[model samples]
Target chain A: MKIKKRLGLILANTILIIASLSVLLPILWVIRTSIANRLIAYKIPPVWIFTPTLDNFRMIFETYPFQDYFLNSLIISTAASLVALLIGSLAAYSIARFRTGDPALRLSMLSTQMLPPIALVIPIFLIMNVIKLWDSMTGLVLAYLSFNLPYTVWILISFFQGIPVEMEEAAMIDGCSRFQSLIRIVFPVALPGLLSAGVYNFILNWNEFLFALILTGRNTRTLPVAISSLWTQQGVNIGAVSAATVITILPVILLTFVIQKFLVRNLTFGSVK
Target chain B: MAKSSFFSNLPKHDQQTARNLVVPAMLGIWVVVLFPLLYALYVSVHDWILSQGGIGSFNFSNYFTVLKDPLLLNSAKNTVVLTISVVVLEILIGFGLALLLNNKGIRLRNIYLFILLIPMLMPPITVGLIWRLLLHPELGIINYVLSVIGLPQPLWLATPNLAMLTIIIVDVWHETAFIILVLLAGLTSMPEEIYEAAIIDGASSRQKFQFITLPLMAPTILVATIIRMIAALKTYDLVYILTRGGPGISTETISYYIYKVFFVALDVGKSSAMAFLLLLVIILMTFLLMKVMQKTEQNY
Candidate 1:
């Protein structure tokens, strides 16, 4: 029995070690390739060690205008998420506090999140073209609201519901208007929820591809779109593409880890928590 | 009607405040999501082609055409296969890992978990690109390593069958982290006293899992399954970046196919109809899954 137990422990560790390595090896390979020189990046019987250089990064920024694309991703992600959070929190507060749409309203809001983007993008593309907003920053930001608004509202509704009404009521009793109480009392209390929801939405937007792919022009392409375009242009520039991939994903990885603890709660939409 | 009924239950002053608060979000949804869907429905039924100039005629032929299209059929098949394959593999692998991680004897569990989850939120495009580089036939490290071990180095993204498998592998790599995260959370949050009671009852490990863990975890697993299925059904970016639904369309998904119909063929009406059809499949699947979940819960 003791031998059997020891064997089981060994087996478990072996499986975990394999799983962890599989996940880490590819990411580490990409990072290594990203910093390698052109020849070393794609060398057959790949180089085991080499001095890292920033030429690939410089190439992406100087030759490809990745800075603009990065800025575009930042701006669009921030704008869409902030807008969604601002209005979504209000609606969620109402729904939670007053039962503002009750069963139907709340259900409908969530169901909207399930609407496939392909379904929505069709009309959106046509409408944007008709209105001469195609490939514009405003058009993509507005389009993102289709998912972000509903998501923020749904997630925030749960958060708002978790807060007690007595806090807001006390503020109201202390000569605070409904709005003031919300601003002073409820907002501070729900700050974590708001931040998590906002960050989650921003990440979604930042990594969004299809809508941005179809909607943006040269001047407004987000990082994902920009990175994809790098792949299709001319011959395969493995070094440059590696650098671009690193650039596109590095911030997202950092942000994801920053919010790692809240991820389960956020991803499950507060269901498990 | 539901709104009015809900509003009537609130005090008069509160009703005004609620309406004011909810309207902006409602309007945002309407403008961005609801309005576009309604418009797509309208467009789907009309003979509208962008290059052909405006909504020409009202007809149901677009739906008929989209339904009859062989490519759409092929894409639907691919999507079903991809969705089922990825969800099943991810769940099985994720559940296994989560159980191992949840084991009381495991050390360095948190460190292993953090490493495992690094790909959870990386952009799918980058995931695709990274794999694409790693899988490059001549230059990639994968082939190099394979050659070192005296194994065959297959063209991962070039052959039709291999291309589909490659995409599936990449997706499993990218998305299994989410399943692990969810299931692990469920496993850890389970009541510990129940297990203690099971131990007192002289339950073997297998029996304990089958009798206690499986039944209790049904709901959380179902929730994870539903969310993954929904997302898998709409997969687009990975296919776009990795294969472009190429090697003779072996990996084409419904969304990728619709994208081609709309952008490449410029067939707006037909593509819209296809998109709606995809939406219908998703909604029906979700409904069916929820029904199954309800039945399972009742049994427990």
Candidate 2:
């Protein structure tokens, strides 16, 4: 029995190690190739050891205007998510505490959250073109709200529902107005939830490709668009593409770890929670 | 539960306050989502090709034209195949990993999880780009390794069927993390007392899982499946980045096909009609999946 249990344990760890390597090796290969010079990057047998260079990163920024794209991504993601959290939190609080919209409105929010970006992006693209908001930050941010707003409200409704209402009611009973109680009591207590929703929305906006691809032009292109354009450019630059891929994904990986605890809850729209 | 308390149950003054609070979000959703969808509905009926001219006369035939288009039909088939394949593979692999990690005797579980979950948050564009380089015919390390081992080095994205399989493989690599995370959460949250009771009764591991874990996990599995299915049904980025629906349109998903219509063909009206059709398919699939899952849950 003891030997059999030990074999099972070894087998589980072996399987886990293989799975982890499957994920890690690709990323490590990317990172390895990212710093390799053009010659070594494309070597058939592969150069397992080499002095890494920052030239690829430097090349992407200089040749590709990645710095501008990075800044655009940051500004758009931040603005869209902050707006979503502000508006979404109020509505979520109302719905959670008072069941404000009850089934109909809440159901719409859930359904809208499930609406494919393709369904929304095509019309938004046409409208943005018509309104001359195409290639503009404001237009992209608004387009992002189509998903981010519904998602934020849905995730946060559950968060707000979890917060006890007694504290807000106590403050109301003392002298605070409902608005004051909301700001002072509920918001403060729901700070972690608010932060989680904000970060989650921010990540979604940052990584959003389809909307950003169609709506934004040269001036407003985000990182994903910029990186995709690298592949389409004439002679595929392997090192530069790897470097660019690393740059685009690095912050997201970091931000993901920051909000790791809340990810399952947020991604499932708090249904798991 | 406090959730049962309706807005009508609140005082009149409080009810007014709640309504006021919800207005901004309602307004935001209206302008951003509802209006565009309504406009999309309006546009789908018109003949609008931007490069040619402005919106033309009301033409409901856009839907019929798209339905008749071989490319649209081809893409619909591809989308269904891709969605089912990816969702099933991700769930199985992810569930297997989750169960392994859930074992109490397993060591280095957290480290394994951290590595596995990294791909969950990666931009689909970057994920596609990374795999594109790795799967490149001549210079990619994968081909090199396969050759060194004296195995057949297949053309990953060059051939028709190979391109579709490559996309599916890449998606599983990128998205299985979500399933692992969700199902792992579900597994860890299961009551220890019930498992202890089963163990005391000399229940084997297989029997414990069959009777207890699988039945209890049915709801969570359903939720994860539905969410992944919806996203997979609308897949576009990987197709765009990896193959651009090519090797002669073999891997063209519906979303990618619609995108080509809108941007490449400059046919706005047709694309909008196609988009609505895709949405209809998604909603119907989601509804049907839910019904099936509920039935399975009851049976379990």
Q: Which stretches of candidate 1 lie over 4 Å from their true place?
A: B1-7, B288-300
State the C-alpha RMSD over the true interface residues for candidate 2, after superposing those residues.
Answer: 3.3
lDDT value, residue A192 of candidate 2: 89
Each model's C-alpha lDDT? Answer: 0.89, 0.90
- What DockQ do the predictions score, one after another? 0.64, 0.64
- All candidates: TM-score: 0.97, 0.96
lDDT of 2 by residue, A1-273 (tens): 999999999999999999999999999999999999989988888888899999999999888899999999999999999999999999988888888877677767777877878889988987887799999999999999988898888788877877788888799899998899989988898898899889989999889999998899989999999999988894689999999999999999999999888998988767675
- Residue B266, candidate 1: how far off, in angstroms? 0.5
Candidate 1 docking quality: incorrect, acceptable, medium or high = medium
Candidate 2 stretches with Cα past 4 Å from truth are B1-5, B285-300
Question: Residue B87 in candidate 1 has what lDDT?
Answer: 96
**A1-273 in candidate 1: lDDT tens per residue?**
899998998999999999999999999998898899998987898888899999999999999899999999999999999999999999999988888867678767666777788999889988998899998889999999998998898888877877889988898999999999999988899998899999999999999999999999987999999888898893579889989989888888889987777798777655666
- Superposed by TM-score, candidate 1 places the C-alpha of residue B247 at a distance from the truth, in angstroms, of 0.7
Evaluated on chain A only, model 2 obtains a TM-score of 0.98
